[model samples]
Each structure stands twice: as structure tokens, then as C-alpha cells.
Target: MEKLRLYIQIHQLKEQGFKIAAIARKLEISRNTVYKFLGMSFEEATDWVVSLGRRRRKLDRYQDHIVYWLR
Candidate 1:
């Protein structure tokens, strides 16, 4: 399924009161993604989906700066 359509369907499931983890299991995606969709406004989720598929990231990339700046 395409990302946008899937997003809309997930949004509906959320409105119907399904838990995030259950939706993720049914959809075969990550629990974090489901929870994130649950928390985001539609516009925010749209922008997020558009941005999410665009790149790779590593924890180490941000950790260095955070560790340097944080106590």
C-alpha cells in the first residue's frame, strides 16, 4: 500500500480507539511509528511522512554534539 493511504487508515484506527501497538502489529510496521502517528496532527504527520523516507541517520551523528554540550 502507498504511504499516504496507509497513513489515513491508521488515523481512522486511532480515532476508533485501537492501541498503537496493536495497530503496528496488524500493519506489520514499528510500534514507534504507530505511536508517532497517533500523536501527530494530520498536517504534521503528512510533513513527517514526506520527510521520513528521505534519508538515513545514525545515533552517533547527534550524540557527539549532545555529549559535548551536555553535562
Candidate 2:
């Protein structure tokens, strides 16, 4: 997720001697996110969860009247 991308960008910056602000601007990620991953290990970064939303939850099952009403 974002954390993994942050880790990669930070490491790439170190090897290229890029400035923090410049890297942050180019990467289009917040400065705080960049800084958080600055010295973090890959495993530490990868543990982040992108979401826990009920994206696959079917609203129709919960609201039978709504489905019939809409149809």
C-alpha cells in the first residue's frame, strides 16, 4: 500500500542523495508519510492495512424492500 511505496521512495532517495521535500513533491505523497518511512524497515512498512471497508457487502440482502422499490 502507501507505506510500501513510501519505504521504496525513501530508500531510493538515500541512494540518489535527493532532498526530502523534493522527493515528497515528486512522489505526490505527504511529507509526514515520507518521513515516517525514512528509517523504517520494509517489514515494518508492509504491515499497514489499506482498508477494512465492507466493499463486498450486499446492501440488497439487508434491505429487500429497497431492492424491490428501486427495481
Go through the candidates in order and give the clash count of each.
Answer: 0, 0
Clashes of 1: 0
Q: Please estimate how well model 1 matches the true structure, expressed as its whole-model Cα lDDT.
A: 0.78
Query: Over the stretch 1-71, how does candidate 1's per-residue lDDT look in tens digits?
Result: 27667778788887788888878988899988777666777788778777877767787579878898996
- Note the Cα lDDT for every prediction shown: 0.78, 0.71
Best by the lDDT measure:
1
Q: What is the per-residue lDDT of model 2 for residues 1-71, given as tens digits with 9 covering 90 to 100?
A: 65566688688986799877888888887788777788677766665433323245666476878877889
Question: Which candidate number would show the highest TM-score if scored against the true structure?
Answer: 2
Looking at model 1, residue 25 earns an lDDT score of 84
Please give the distance, in angstroms, between residue 60's alpha carbon in candidate 1 and its true position after superposition.
22
Quote the lDDT for 47 in model 2: 53
RMSD of every prediction: 8.6, 5.0
